[model samples]
Target: MRRVRQLAERTPADRERYVDLLRAVAITAVVLGHWTVAVVGYDAAGRPTGRSALPDLPWAYPLTWVAQVMPVFFVVGGFANAASLAARRARGGDAADWLLDRSARLVRPTTVLVLVLAAGALVARLAGVDPSTTRTVVWFATVPLWFLAAYLLVVPLTPLTYALHRRYGLAVPVVMAALVGLGDLARSTDHAGLALGNYLFGWLAVHQLGYVWYDARRKVGARFPPARGVGWTLLLGGLTVLVLLTTVGPYPVSMLNVPGEPLDNAAPPSLALLVLTITQLGLIMVLREPAERWLRRPGPWQAVIAVNAVVLTVFLWHLSAAILLVGGLDAVGLLPTPPVGSPAWLAWRVPWLLMLAVVLAALVAIFGPVEARAGRHRLPVKDAAPDGADRPSDARHQRHPLRAGLAVAGFVAVGAALVMNAVTPREAAEPLGLPVPALLAYLAGAGVLRVLRERPDTRGPTPPASPR
Candidate 1:
């Protein structure tokens, strides 16, 4: 608590604290939602199984309007990335340098999670544990990777997308939304493969909106968020379209992927998800003023900082924490099995959530240091001259062609591996209890990125200062 206070006190006066607040809220909602709604246990045949209770709780689908907070994350990501890239460029850094810095933060913690899961899966397989059971557990543990995969798909393109944002403003997201709609239409007609295109376009659309929000903050000053009317407009308009899509059109009302649903909103991201994102953005904007004010208080601000500090770790290992709890309880034959959505189940959630929270806290404490270390590894960015002259020296901005290619290849490999695992979990689980190939691909990519990040300046010996 003291450390959190000190960190909160150190926050820059000019910083947009609301963005951090939103990120904390988004991740918290995701964690709690997953823990509360998920059902994991051994079946009568003694086979492990897992599923979301949202399928049985039809009444809960509409609640997903607020619970599915991925859009909020992407929007906050956009704002943060736009700011980060701009700062990096201002400090004479190029896209590769920025990529190295930004991607490492994600890749490092993710690497830790993947390696741990892979090792556990391998050990389980070697112990003669049922391959199917191991695979199911691994799948459940790896659920968080899908979001990382989607975020990574759009992260490397920030430089390109931010440039487009500068030129086209709101039009960038408009075009992206149109593409998502098209993808949704194609998927409706059974052209499922064609809809895969939205894997990038849909998330990118929500992300681009963050760029818009960034610009709006700059224009309106940090004290305000666009206009209240703008928020209302987005809220009503997006909700209208979302209603039509789900009801009159063919989209599912649930933002989550309900089993047996022919058309779900989330897997590849449908038009409905995009609109839900818009609606969410609207609600966020509408509340930003009050939220920002509340966040200024020491208690809330410190909590936000504390959570953001290990947000990725919390996200990455939370499901695994649940898995650990379930496995332990099941081994003792003490796991609860009330029918999902029943009153008994609802009552059971209190203690279930409490136990899960304790386990997740322990997991976060153990692995959270890795995330902190990654943040510390960031290379210092040089500030501009006092006169504000450009100082993007060759050494600072340029990259060796080979290193550059390797960086691109690294990113592509990581992105492709994650997408494959996310989009095709069953296939990724073959030959091992884990997604070994994907893990290898991620490791290879992270290795290249790590090498690029740590290597000395490739420009070689600094020319001696010319005689003044």
Candidate 2:
């Protein structure tokens, strides 16, 4: 509590608190939603089997639409990325320097997660556990990284995309939307190979909206009348499109991909999801005023900062906590897992979620500092006195060609590895050798980035920095 209070107090008065609030809310929803729907049970032989529990309820599909918060995350990411890039540019920073700064904060904590997963997989393999079980567990564990992979790929392109935002404004997202529509068409025709670009297009479009939000706010202030009513229209229009797509267009109503179902609204996000993003963006714009006012209070702002501090840790490990609890209890025959969608199961969700929260809190405590320490090194204020002037990080004014080249290679390797891993087949948590190449690539990238030239910049993230 003291630490949180201190964070609040330390925050610059001019900082935008609401962005952090949005990020916290979005991630919280994701964590809770996972706990709510994840159906972990035992097979006839007593091995763990899991899938989304939504189908059992029969009435929960519509709720999943409300619960799906991934779009909000990308929107927040876009805003932060645009702001961070602006700040970097204000102080003579280059594209590489800005990307390096952003990547380090993200990659460092992810390394810890990947390594932990690797060790767990190795242990499971040594136990003579079914390779299939191990493979399934590993794949399920890696599920969350899909977001990281896509976000990481997007980070490198901020310079280009931000340029498009500058040159074309709203047209950028609209064009991206059209491409998403095309991707959906290819998907409908079973041209899965050709539809791969939609993943990039879908997320980029949400992110582009953030750029729109940031630009509009800067230009017109948050109270702009035009932005407010867009929310209601988006809410209704998106809901209508969602209904038609599910009922009339072959897309699933559930935003999340349910196991045993052929439709996945998320994996290669469909056009319906784009409407959902528009709706989320609308809500965000409409709520900005009240949300910003509420966040201005010291206590609320402090909570937001504290949550953002360990947000990555919370995101990376929440599912791991749930998995451990479920697997451990099931192994000992102490788990009281009710039949899927049963009344008892519905009643048990409260305690189940509470237990997961407790465990996740502990995991955050253990791993969160890794991210916080790295964040403290963001670029410095553009100007400062020379007599022991405050510098943002411990960076020295030096550059290494070898280090820069290695950084390029490292990023490429990481991107390729994450993509390969995501597409690779894994049935029973058994991956060939427990090696996580992406973790290595990220570490390599971070080490190289650390050696790149560091410049001073206090233009800090539109004052409302969130992970992009």
Candidate 3:
């Protein structure tokens, strides 16, 4: 444990850019994937079917390779957890408080969003909309809520997870691999006794790998690249696993595809996912320097950073915007039913998707300010130390990365599990719950806001020197 602590402290602060860029890329992929899958359909009663029309697009399956970016989100999340924990520990703060503070920051905004959406759904139903259409809108609107639950489950378990990472080191991967293999075997034989553990054990395993990478970066610094030979080997290994699982393995390649079985890789995720994470991590490591360089550019990087700040808002509202656009357009008699799988039908969808983006942008423009206002109270202002004094003993300064990580894991695990059990029993306890991703997005948005608030603007005009 002492050795691990020392290693975690060695890396400088600027080494985190790669992970941030990776996060930006991952969120973008998710948005695009959702857009591609958006299609307008209706039942015989003239009500919207709330399903995608482009189900047969040749590019849909292959999109999974790039669009299934959730693993990368977890990896970056682990990195942020490590950094925050280490910062807090150095300031002499209690690990529990650090975790609690972060948890509140994540959960508060999400609760606001979910409650708002839920209320809207209820009102819509009372307006006499078809039951199926109302249900579809509500379900799609709540998709982003699953992240919140999943993340809350993981947040509280951070301490235990960090301890496991320290004690087991690379053995963490081995254990996760075993869980995946065992889960797969059980799933194959129609026994899902251990299936409930996949979200925690399986995906958490990948998050733990992010911890390993975080520790590794601290030891070697950002500029140090992995040997070319080793990098290619890991890359090839990840791709090989992905190919086998998608093509030959019982699982389908389309990460979005819903299987009939109780255990769906698209939902809670499976071991094959860790392979994808490993591959992504290796690829990031190989291009770390270049990626960092690219991200340093103000024009593009600023946009990336801006989007990162509002990623949660985007994820939670994108589907709602799409649904609204489709329903609104259909009411105006601008769209008519077309044969499925036809080029003409798909062409018609392009305009609606664009309109959806506009609606989403409008929502962001309006609600973004509201969310920011709410976020201000939820996130501790970085510049505002306790009593405005630079107390080293303050919680912000004394947080340890390992402890913070553990606290986060613990909070998320307990909170999400409880929420899932209460709301959606079948999907809640499993990976399909909305709590995890919502929690992550909430945390990330809060973290970014805190960092931005705390960080001094080095590029701005120089202030007059204070008299001594």
- TM-score pick, better of 2 and 3: 2
**Highest TM-score scorer:** 1
lDDT of 2 by residue, 392-442 (tens): 242321233344355455565666556666776766344432334644554
Off-target runs (Cα >4 Å) in candidate 1 are 219-224, 376-401, 423-432, 456-468
The C-alpha TM-scores of every prediction are: 0.91, 0.86, 0.76
Question: lDDT by residue for model 1 over 390-421, one digit each (tens)?
Answer: 23444554646566667777887887777666
Provide the overall lDDT of each model, using Cα atoms, as 2-decimal numbers: 0.77, 0.71, 0.59
The C-alpha local distance difference test score for the whole of candidate 3 amounts to 0.59
lDDT of 3 by residue, 97-178 (tens): 4455555446445555655654564576577644445445556666665665666666556556766787788798678778
CA shift at 435, candidate 2, in angstroms? 5.4
Cα misplacement distance, residue 314 of candidate 2 (Å)? 0.7
Error of model 2, residue 128, in angstroms: 3.9
Q: Which residue segments of model 3 deviate by more than 4 Å?
A: 1-15, 52-59, 125-133, 220-225, 259-263, 336-340, 370-468
